[model samples]
Target: MTDSAHIASGHATRPIGGGGGKIFGFPLRGFGLVSSLLLSFASALFTFCVTTMVAIFALLIYRANGHAAVDMAISYRDFGFPASLVVLAIALPLFLTLWIRAKIMG
Candidate 1:
C-alpha cells in the first residue's frame, strides 16, 4: 500500500490540491472565530463566579442552622423523598438555565 501514515495525516507525498486552498469548504475567516472564542471565555467566567457564590451561601446556611434545618424538615413530615426531589428540581433548572445561556451567548 502507499504510505498509510501520510494519507492519515492528510499530507501525502503529493500536494493534492493546487495553491493550498481552503480546507472543509470554510474560508478560515479570522474575525468571527476570535469573537466566538472571546464570548465563550467570558461566559465560562461568569458562570463559574455565580455558581461559586451560590455554593458558598448554601454552605453558610447549612453551618449556621445545622440541627435546626434538619429538625425543620422533619417537622414538615415530608423529609424523605419530597424535600430531596424539590431541591433537585429547583437546583437542576437553575444550573441548566445558566449553562444554556452561557452556550447561546458564547
Candidate 2:
C-alpha cells in the first residue's frame, strides 16, 4: 500500500505508549511503566525539594547569622527536611483535590 492509501484508510495510528493509564490529566504515553507510576509523585517531590531548598536558604540567612549560622547550618541541616515533607504532604492532597474538582467542572 502506498502512503496515500494508508492515509485514506482513516486508521491513523497512535504512537505506542506506556500501555493503559491516565494519572490526573496526564496520559501515560511514551513513558515506561515505572516512569508512568512515578509521574504523579514527580510534581509533589519537585515541590518538596524546591520548598526545602528555599526554606534552608531563608533560614540560614535570616535566622542563622555569622558564627551562629555556621553552627546551626551543620546541626539543623535536616530541619527543613521534616518541615518541607509535612508541607508537601498537606499540599499534595489539596492540589489533587482541587485538580480533580477543576477537571470535573470542565
| Per-residue lDDT of candidate 1, residues 35-105 (tens digit) | 54444454555554555555556656776985344343332334333443454555455445544554565
Q: Tens-digit lDDT track for model 2 on 66-97?
A: 53444445323565556556655775564555
| Candidate 2 minimal-lDDT segment of 10 residues | 67-76
Candidate 1, residue 14: the lDDT equals 47
TM-score of each: 0.34, 0.38
Provide the overall lDDT of each model, using Cα atoms, as 2-decimal numbers: 0.48, 0.55
Clashes of each: 0, 0
